[model samples]
Target: MNKLTAVAVSVLLLSAAPAQAQSIPGWKAYRAQQTGQQAAPAANAGQAPAAPPQATDPQPAALPQPAYQTAAAPYATRPAPKPAPNGGLFVGVQGGSGWVYEDVDQRAVAVSAGYRWQAGDYSQVGIELGAGRLDETTWRDYGIPEVKFNTIGANARFNFGNSPWFGVARLGYWHARSRDGWDRKVTADGAYGSLGVGVDLGRHFNLQLMYTGYTYAVDSYYGDDEYDINRADTVTLGAEVRF
Candidate 1:
């Protein structure tokens, strides 16, 4: 009986030692699992989801502008003009009547032609020819008669610049033929001169007032004549034109 009890106690102690060893191994395994779980979470938190692949091409930057550029130009301007000069050629006509005091008082018609050359700014020289008829007349109670005369002359003119007026001196020669109702013919040669002043109207027309003088010689059946000079003075008012 005593041997049997000692054996039973040894068996019981052996069984308890095995159980404690088994428990230690199980506790170590549980702790390792918990530590592994904590480490996993920390690693996950630290590693950012692999940074989304960084872009290769970056966005473009803005460019700058230039400060010194050229501007446009401005406009231009202009000028003025001048004037003309004066002086040229001229021509025209004249008509009027005159008288011879004491010797013969007559009415006549005359046609004349002439040319003038300018001698200065206000002066001219010219020559003229004219002819006319005379009415019934007698000289010195000699029963002489009526005659017609032909005249030729030259003249010089002077003009006043401030006015349209001029002064003239004329020298001329004349020839006359007479008819006395007798069976004879008579003729005379003479010289004459005139002094005058005239006013010009526009466009080559002028009005004139003049004093005329005549000296003559006669040839007839009356006899050989000496100093057959006849003297006459007259006034003429006429108009003239220019070409």
Candidate 2:
């Protein structure tokens, strides 16, 4: 029996020896390594994975601007006006009747030619030459005939505004050389003044009616040899044109 116990103890010792060798630092080091690996994974559990590499945004390039240009300025000026012509000349004719009252009644018919010079818009000056025949019947001088005379004058006129109407005044000298029934041929020289109104038909035509007064001095007569003066009146109508 003792021998059998010894064999069993030997076997036991051999197994205990193997366990002691592994119990040295080597066994502890292997256990710690395994525990650390398990704890590391557990501690990192809540941590997020590294974010995927971030993509960088690209910046936009600047655009080019348009260049500025200035505009030109405007200028002002007035246009010239047309010029006007100078003086105008005109010629015309006139005809009318007259009366000389004395102890007898004498009637006359007159015809005249005239020229006018325009001084301005409102004034004019002119001259005229005329002649006429007169019929006289006094004391029933049975076979009496007609008498005739020559006349000449100068006149001035003024227009009112630009209308067709005008006021006129004239002074003139006239001579009448009697050509009929008087015993001694008589000659008369006279001063005459007149007043009238006129119408301008256009730049080319015009008409006027006037009353004239004449004062005359006679050279020879049927009765008086001295200087004897008499008054006479007349009405005239005229037409004229510009050249």
Candidate 3:
């Protein structure tokens, strides 16, 4: 019986020994596992660590803008105006007081025709031919012998200035005939000068006032005796029409 007890005790101890040993940690195996864990980091040390992802704000999209360009305009030109005709011909008439050879009692009238050209911007040069008659008293106190003396003349006129109004000057020659130079007379000539102002009533009409003087000569038939008639003065009001 003692022998049986000793054998049972040995068998129980043997079974418990394995269980206790396995429950407790082993130093060699634990150290070897720790070394393997430590060595894993060292093995990967040659490779770089990846950087952490960065947070970013979203950007707004850009809008399209309008573009501008400059271009120059084309140059333009205009035409000039034509000038008015300057070669128009005209005709006229004049009347009022006139005297012969210092005689204040002579009364006269005239008709004229003319041609002119524009000489410059505001001036004209022209020729005028005229014919007329004057009533003259040779011897008033001696029962008054009266005669209408026939006269003819020509003039060169200058018109100057540039408005509705203008100034005029004239130089001329005149011839006179006495119905009776004491009884029948011969033909003779006279000299004259004139000055005046005029207004243009419209594109084709004119009005004027003038002062003029003349030196007249005449002859009688018997010896065809010649004599001079002096200081013939005149004041004239005139009008003209143009084409």
- Pick by lDDT: which candidate is best? 2
Residue lDDT tens for model 1, 43-139: 8996767677776897688655443323332333333221111122333233444454473566544455677777766777878776665455455
Candidate 2: global Cα-lDDT? Answer: 0.69
The total number of steric clashes, by the backbone 3 Å criterion, in model 1 comes to 7
Which regions of candidate 3 fall more than 4 Å away from where they truly are? Answer: 1-86, 101-103, 136-160, 218-229
Q: How do the residues 18-84 of candidate 3 rate in per-residue lDDT, one tens digit apiece?
A: 7877666795577679999999899889978877888888798876553422333345444444334
Candidate number achieving the greatest TM-score relative to the actual structure: 3
Each prediction's TM-score against the native? 0.53, 0.53, 0.54
The 10 consecutive residues of candidate 1 with the worst lDDT sum are 79-88
Q: With candidate 2 superimposed using the best TM-score fit, by how many Å does residue 236's alpha carbon deviate from the native?
A: 2.2
lDDT of each: 0.66, 0.69, 0.67
* Count: clashes, candidate 3: 0
lDDT of 3 at 45: 93
Minimal lDDT window, size 10, model 2: 78-87
Q: 55-158 in candidate 2: lDDT tens per residue? A: 88878776664433232323434544322221255555555656665444455566666666767757878887766666755556554445566667886778
lDDT of 2 at 154: 80
